[model samples]
Target: MKGTETKAPGVPQALVDLVGDHFLEAARYLREIQDAYPKEFVSVAKKLKVGRRKAYELVRIDRRFHDLGIAPERLRQIGWTKLAHLASHVDADNVEKWLALAETVTAHELKMLLRGTVIDPETRAVVLYLDKVQYGIFETALLTAGAIKDSGCLLNREAALTRLLDGVVVE
Candidate 1:
């Protein structure tokens, strides 16, 4: 996957710059708050207006990755969700391999892999975040194209997208 790109198409470059690796910064700030107010950390997190669960998750990832000396660049590259799955298993010795694996697989598949489940090496995953209207359009398009099934399983959706793309001609 060396030549493969991780793209956020339709997202503004300025927005991307402004939001660069924000989760890493959030983790750092949350850790400082935790250190200053050990007992009231959860309350502090709540007061910050972020969900308590998300705050805890950020803290956990921060502590684990910080203690392991994982670089911010690498963490940003792997993204938070996949890093959560890799956190327990990653160390100085195996960090590179785990990072590469995380880059190649989706978070769900990475979770399954960590749990000793076998997955197809050739399988790839794409994650999308769409607004309500965008999601409606996308769902309709895929459903109309017969890409999505009644059950709407992820694998089926993936296959549908692949099949649709296979017919496309790119210049």
Candidate 2:
């Protein structure tokens, strides 16, 4: 998000400059690749020596800066994790405020503020119908992932139920 222009504290200025250039170039190339082939984003990511997740973050940084109201130079300095976290909050009016707040807090504190207990397991639940095979596979996967009971077993329905999303974050 576009905020007041200033270099971030405690990082080498040279690295900040490099990040701005690199993210811009990467975003430009990724946009071209996506536009030309549409389905080759994965291949583009592989060629760039970055994971799909990191590639997505870079593109988001590039393409959404205007929408997110973030300056490219500011974007380069905040790093990917905070940038991605801020994505949900930034908008034309609040971008400046968010950036100001980010600067005042540690990265961890900024994250905690933005996260804000929305994903607390105690406050969430889901009910769904899984087909027999889907249920079976889900159960097996959970067992392998150690979500099963201490006795090493789960009811058919409980397999996917036991922390199905316990440590898994879909976003």
Candidate 3:
């Protein structure tokens, strides 16, 4: 499914410049992955021992599937062979399986998978890791990190959630 309409607002331009296009792709991919394996996503994130924030970071940079340049619809037709090609760039561990599952899902199924799954027991940490490892720190993470840097304080899940929910207005 496409991402939720919940755009992150108030992001700084510098952060956007730092992250670039990859960030957007990563965010999109994360939504897709989550759609494919709602329970598995949470389980894997827990297994990886990453918190919600760190999980987000990891998934963001983990763009093996998106980088393949295959159309979402085409993914289902080609299946694992296609996904395997995409998985080459990112870590091969769990992605192979995730991509395979993604191939079986429809856009509407993906959307349903993400609904009510955005925030949960392990979501915050998983999202953070996804952002860091998979997508890399993009505008959202950079702005968040910068805010913390300026304040001389670290922001936790509650803080990040608040800002994210508030919406990061793209300039």
Question: Global CA lDDT of candidate 3, please?
Answer: 0.45
**Model 2, which residues run further than 4 Å from truth?**
1-21, 67-70, 117-171
Tens digits of per-residue lDDT, candidate 1, 39-75, equal 6667655555557767777787888788676678878
Task: Report the C-alpha lDDT of model 3 over 61-158, residue by residue, as the tens digit.
Answer: 34555565545555445443334334433454655554554566543343334342332333322344354554345435645644343454443535
Clashes by residue pair, model 2: 1-69, 1-70, 2-69, 2-70, 2-71
User: Per-residue error at 135 for model 2, in Å?
Assistant: 25
Q: Model 3 segments beyond 4 Å from truth?
A: 1-33, 64-171
Off by over 4 Å in 1: 1-20, 120-171
Ranking, TM-score, top scorer first: 1, 2, 3
> TM-score of the candidate numbered 3?
0.21
What's the lDDT for residue 113 in model 2? 79
The count of backbone overlaps in candidate 3 is 50
TM-score of 1: 0.54
As a whole number from 0 to 100, the lDDT of residue 87 in candidate 1 is 69
- In terms of TM-score, which candidate is strongest? 1
